[model samples]
Target: MTSRFTELVVDCHDPEGLADFWCRVLDFKVIDRGEGKVEIGSWVPTVEEVRARQMPPTLLFLQVPEGKTVRKNRLHLDVSPVDRSTQDEVTRLLGLGATTADVGQDPDASWVVMADPEGNEFCVLRTLAPQE
Candidate 1:
């Protein structure tokens, strides 16, 4: 049997806060919360959907003592706008607390680097459905 990608866990100081930020960014909703963990994803799937392996991977924010000490992220996510232009999405993210981060990309790079509230870097790519 082959394994399917499921979830991505992130270490942060405030799980709920980070989850909230990501939920707004990704248009996801909080699905679960525990002592120090907050799980967010697209709306919960039915059992059949889960069995069919059709669920998008969820993000679980875990609280950690030594949170985000690194200067840069070793692994980052790249997101594309679903219904809006990349520049509009970047503006929306900035309004939601994401800050522009410079990881020494060339001026003509196709992606924009931005950091979440906990300083995790992610890139915003072109819109998913390009205008015709």
Candidate 2:
């Protein structure tokens, strides 16, 4: 028996805005929506191929009155660019409303800590070759 990730449910004040932001960041698309939630799924062929056994996990943004807190999140996402350099990707993300974030990490760390428009923290990992 094996288990595969199917969805990542995120609580947010504006499901529409978060979905838009993540869609651009991940090259995803808004595929579904409900009364209080929006689901974003992948459009990348490689990503879909990697999850051939089933569909890849969708980023599900659900409605929440209280948004992110002042304290850091217990869990955060780490992303790697498939084709572009890490610095370029980070710069593009910054242009898309992402901001550099600090969470007490050593300055020499490889990953770039960043926060979304809603202040959720995620890391931009080292870039990977397209073949990777």
lDDT string for model 1 (23-111, tens) is 99988999999999999998775666666775788999999999677787899999999889999999999999999999888879989
Candidate 1 wrongly placed segments (more than 4 Å): 45-51, 130-132
Q: lDDT for every model?
A: 0.89, 0.87
Score every model by TM-score: 0.90, 0.85
* Poorest stretch of ten by lDDT in candidate 1: 45-54
Per-residue lDDT of candidate 2, residues 1-132 (tens digit): 366777888899889998999999999999888888999988433454545676567899999999777668898889999889899999999999999999998899999999998899999999895744
What TM-score would candidate 2 get against the native? 0.85
Candidate 1 is scored at a TM of 0.90
Most TM-score-accurate candidate: 1
- Candidate 1, pairs of clashing residues: none
